[model samples]
Target: MTDILDSTAAGTTRGAVSSLFPATIGRFEAPEDRALIDGLSRWVEQHFREQLGQRPSCHVYVETLPAEIVALIDRLRDSPVIRELIVRQVPAGSGFEPMKHTDELYISHYNKDRGGDQGLFDRHYDGNLRFLSSSMVVRALIYLQSDASYKVVFGDSRVEKAFTTYDFGLLDFHRELHWVEGNYTPGGPQRILLKCNYLVTAPGAGARGRFALAANTAVFYVVKAAMEYSKSPRTPAQKAVGHLCNLFRRLNIVHPLVPLAAIAASAIGVAVLAYVVVTP
Candidate 1:
């Protein structure tokens, strides 16, 4: 593993122009553990089978992860490469403190043919509060299955190459605009990826930052629900409204207005719902 990190295979980018073009930190192949990879693949398949009725896509949080998965996460967290990348982002003299919370760790499985989740394919940042905070939060994705449809694009870069199994990469969570194309055949392959977020916080985030984070989180859930609702079969009126919301989302790819547009669309939805309910 040390040799791998020191090799020319590792790469990092800095000073991105905007949120659309995020600074990539590193890309490296994780230590080969065929048994562990196979085990996790089976585990994820079974979990979705039992819990999600073999849905096209789903994610499982780290809290419910098996012991082996947890152990693997610990290993990744302690890796020298990941540690160095994280330390570089820390504010000077602010101190480095590792967070143990698992809220931002999860494993996602996506099958294009099974109607993948919009959230997974959407062109959006990683987290709800990502744009609101100055705290450096990095997103790491480790691939379990390789697929060409899973793409990451930066400024002027045409769909970065697909990641192979055991290939893991780290990028700025707040700045990267990742999305997938709508190219799904009837029986395409499933892609399973483990995702983790590493946060390096300044000592005093202050009350405003906390409030902004909470508010953004709430809005995110509401917008998520709206997106899910739009996907289902709906009446003509509902379909029209859904289209409008989708438009807002597409336009949100431009930074600074991403959250604002989402907020406006969500607020419109709430107001309409309120009027409908009270107009009896």
Candidate 2:
């Protein structure tokens, strides 16, 4: 202790950046229920599992956030600290928007055999995956089942390209977290980590400036996506709306199974015509 104090007194301070980028991974004790804004996450995860049956769809992944956390986010979005982090402006053609990070991200394993559609699957849903060229995604994950189990690696662009296959090991890390710190860009910034809960803090990673910033950025995108996916359509007229949504598919407008409910008016029209002809 005295030696450490002496070093501090000598002004041998440490760096505030790690090889990691925007943010770092950590775990804080969530509230008892673990349900809140994440109601959407559960819904989205389950829906994908049911429809895709564990196919390797880039669209399927899971993030589980509990409620007391929601309050934390609501508070941060309005906080001045976050105000400093957001980009107020960018080039018009950048196809990007600045966002604020005010919430903790959830990273839960989503094995179709393990947790395809649990009870909370059917609920409000609102979220989307962030991707570049529709091929890659910036992802964050944590293993609740174990602590200090394994690390999530983010290599330099050269390293990532050289590697073609990776072991999809079971996420058994507890109190430990995993995250990636690269975008679709080449060698932009790479600092990902697999660490204990203590290592996941903004300041902790920020202290070393490794994965913290990237992790922070990824969390922001996840929150925004979730908010968008959970909103429900406000009417029973979803049939018309659903058709409108599928317009780009160019499926036959009305095939044998368009559903009686969907064309109730048309059904009524046909019935009236038949009745009049028979009476005549």
Candidate 3:
């Protein structure tokens, strides 16, 4: 039951960036190895169980996926439309090679009584911390098993839709604000989802690019640390991409204005830096 939104497949025309949001270029069910994903999911659960015991939420990370899954994801990554949508329209660093595969795989497990999902009731973004790299952190979600009760909520109007097993979803990790819904069931059936995080390096513009990357990363951590400790419980350092968006509430900025403020600040900083570099 591939939920294809339109006829656009790999050959879909690239849509304009400005008009792309809320547009579903592709949404379809793809073939998956259910048994393999099941084994993987159970393995992940047991791994977390050993460490954390039977908790309400938990997850495990891996550097690789079953060969079959990887092959499918690789095909999706090769899609020119997906590449342009995720890489070209974002603030990715322009130097390092694009499509560099990292040893990063996330398997999230959520059950009624045991599993780990932190922001179950709250909307949040997904990402990892990168040091001194202006890379666009993008993730494509593949639902291995999702309960009928759960939905991934997004969009300006807070649209929500249930995720079916084998359903694939794409979102801008850095820009889109989304979260899981229907986690209140404490003793319901278990659910699992696989996430692949990929990095795209921007075309490095010599020293300027290097400086920008370093500066951007530095600012991110500084602001992150300042805001992180003020709100919810923190995660492991490696996993703590620092919930930077939560800082918006603490700063009293309206939810809708958060992105605008970030963009404005970035533009101003770049302008100031450029003036300094050129005025000599």
Candidate 4:
């Protein structure tokens, strides 16, 4: 493992990826099967364009991934280093996410020229919001195609490391503030990344973890119910409310405060009505 240290403005040393990234897992090695890599790349292109009618600019969650892709994920997840990290993420061993395997599997495409979802390329950390509340997340990034100039920045001092095709990076998404360092302009090259997240089930000991789990669960079911409500027959006003709920879900802003806001509004309305009645 190569550990290069850089001196930042504060005169403190910012270490290389190895310093910040908890585990390097393995040295840089090309995958043995080039054909499998090519096949996976082709499948990703086709699935997004032909099957889903989505442009390469959009991020996609792969709900029904191909068997080969599934096998690939299995192999990566089962890597010795990854297994150890999983144990480290949740030391108890018994607690696991609702999904036994992967919490989520998704792919991202970034074009230098495209405008949509470009904010992802900005300097920021993955799972920053989720991690703030004691939820530790690990994301494995497998690059199908990459630009060596583009880098993943780490640490408060901001050390950068470039990536290449078939390069695999394991990150502590919850702990580090990492981001892409380069511009993707229209009519320029594109970057395709396949990311799989192994979500740590909220640790059983902390109230924070438990609350995060409960809040996530509640938001999930509320969003699910909103979808069902949208589909079912309803009065125009009810339909409008359902659509509003669905919008909130899509934005991921539905929190305890939302329901509390509604309650407060209703209580105020009731109080006004009672006052008017008494005055009359």
> Can you rank all candidates by TM-score, best first?
1, 4, 3, 2
Worst 10 residues of 3 by lDDT: 1-10
Tell me, what's the RMSD of every candidate?
A: 6.7, 18.2, 10.3, 10.2
Candidate 3 structure quality by residue, lDDT tens digits, 1-280: 1011222322333332222223122333333445555655566456555533444233333325557656544554454444554443433233322222332344334432211234444555433232224444455565655567777776533556777665556664444566666644556545666554444343444554445445434544454344334323345542343343344322322343455477589789999999999997
Candidates 1 and 4 compared: the better one by lDDT is: 1
Tens digit of per-residue lDDT, candidate 4, span 169-190: 6676545555566655443334
Among all candidates shown, the one with the greatest lDDT: 1
Score residue 90 of candidate 2 by CA lDDT: 12
The clash numbers for all candidates, in the given order, read: 0, 35, 18, 5
Runs off by more than 4 Å, candidate 3: 1-32, 45-53, 64-120, 127-136, 156-159, 200-280
Candidate 1 accuracy as TM-score = 0.63
TM-score of each: 0.63, 0.23, 0.50, 0.53
Model 1 residue 50 lDDT score: 60
User: In candidate 1, which residue ranges exceed 4 Å CA deviation?
Assistant: 1-21, 25-35, 50-55, 66-68, 94-122, 127-133, 156-159, 185-189, 202-245, 255-280
**Which candidate ranks first by TM-score, i.e. highest?**
1
Residue range 225-269, candidate 2, lDDT tens digits: 432232232343533343332331122123312332445766798
lDDT of 2 at 99: 23
Model 2 CA lDDT for position 69: 37
> Each candidate's lDDT (Cα)?
0.51, 0.26, 0.45, 0.47
lDDT for 215 (candidate 2): 46
Q: Give model 4's TM-score versus the native structure.
A: 0.53
